[model samples]
Target: MKKLLILISILISLQVQAQRTSAPEGPGSLTFWENLSKHCGKSFEGEMLNASENDQFYGKKLVMHVRTCEDGKITVPFHVGDDHSRTWVLTMEEGNLIKLKHDHRHEDGTEDRVTQYGGLSSNTGMAKVQFFPADQETTDLIPYAATNVWWITLDDTSFTYNLRRINNNSPIIVKFDLTKEVETPPTPWGWED
Candidate 1:
């Protein structure tokens, strides 16, 4: 009877450990989405931390505005110097999944040729960070970006946006200071008020 009890205890311990390892961390992607939504209607200043000389945003002033936030969607406009052509649309899908899409527009309020390229969160990411691997739609929109994985990390002091491509050593990392709010820039191209 003693040996049987010991075996049962071990089995129970193993089962608890399995559950701990398999469960998503913190409140998963919903928590992350909520954390990000906390910055709605605010603007922040950022610097390109890993830009190469040839990078388009190398010498530009970077700004990001959490322009709109709704229950299931958030819209952020990323302004590079005088260019207000880039906007990020984040949508919460069913099952706690979040989709990130880039909305590029011309100065005349028309969609750019290379636009709406992004991905969906593959799993329940942590509360502070989430990874979005290139989806089939992203690959169809931009074949060369098939291996791109974009991640966003939000914390009390800073928010970071990063991108890495498989087999590439260099990554694009931009960090925005969340401690200080900046003046909201003009509306992004193709957006009103």
Candidate 2:
């Protein structure tokens, strides 16, 4: 009876540990990350809500693919028309922070002159929304656009990626409806076909 009791206790402890590791964090970014991972291996189409004529995303068939995911990061390729040169990278930072970076590459599998510019979340934005301000690298890369801020909102109906440029007022929003999952698009530049 004593040996059986010890074995039961050990099993219970192991189960608890497993549950704790797999459970999603709450009231902040962890929940959002887990929810975002739910759509892994899926692709969605987005439309610019307010884009200027000069915007690269303007008048293009915008598609986002959650292509690569891991324990601490997810890489999503954002396609604009035939320009498969942009990717969004989200990384888990210490202290409950989340990092967002824009990775751009060329068709010949080379890095672009302007790439890997993004920011880390400054607060626990919850499962509904997350805001990423331009990091130091972005400030150095594009001094004039240092004030760029990105806010992502996810809900049952839609997932919105909104960008606020300099002065944090001019909004360029791109939103995707969650109910409609589209066929996967082609691989982005520098990726295997």
Candidate 3:
């Protein structure tokens, strides 16, 4: 009876080990998405990394707030001075593809004419960087913006939002210093008052 009990104990231990090693994991690996999601509820101040003197936000206060985060999605709202109309929605698709979409709204809580435009990364970029080319939705929304390509980067010190128009010399860059968490701005335009 002692030997039988020992064998049963070994079998139970092995089963437990196998279950621990093989059980499912949460949203396998959207590393870049995961990295960005880590800053939920934090706000950071940013400036244009490379900008022309006439840039829209040249002297405006730019802030980005990682407002909401869930298992497979995150919403980051970017504020330009008092304009609270831009929110970036990032979703982790079934296969772990990261889809970025811009949700723009008016102060009165209405959708904007030129909004919901973005794309998915062509490959599985590491936690530090990811590049997304203009997707069909983008092309359909804005004809001239069909060639847009965006670069989203994050590191221990900063988070950057960069955009390039293919075959066009102009590129817009917004780099936020992540070393400090700034005061949270007002709720975005479409959110509950």
**TM-score top scorer:** 1
Model 3 — which ten-residue stretch has the worst lDDT? 22-31
What TM-score, over all chains together, does every model reach?
0.85, 0.82, 0.82
Give the alpha carbon lDDT tens digit for every residue of 1-193 in model 3: 4554475359446544654564344442365576677889999999996677798888899999999898888899999999999998888776667888999999998999988999987765545666689999999999888889886877678888878786655567899999999999999998763
* Models ranked on lDDT: 1, 3, 2
lDDT of 1 at 125: 68
Separate clash counts for every candidate: 0, 0, 0
- TM-score quality measure for candidate 1: 0.85
Model 1, position 164: C-alpha lDDT score: 75
lDDT of 2 at 153: 77
lDDT tens string, model 1, 36-90?
Answer: 8899999999998878889999999899999999889999999999999999999
Local accuracy by lDDT, each model = 0.86, 0.80, 0.80
* Candidate 1: RMSD to truth: 10.6
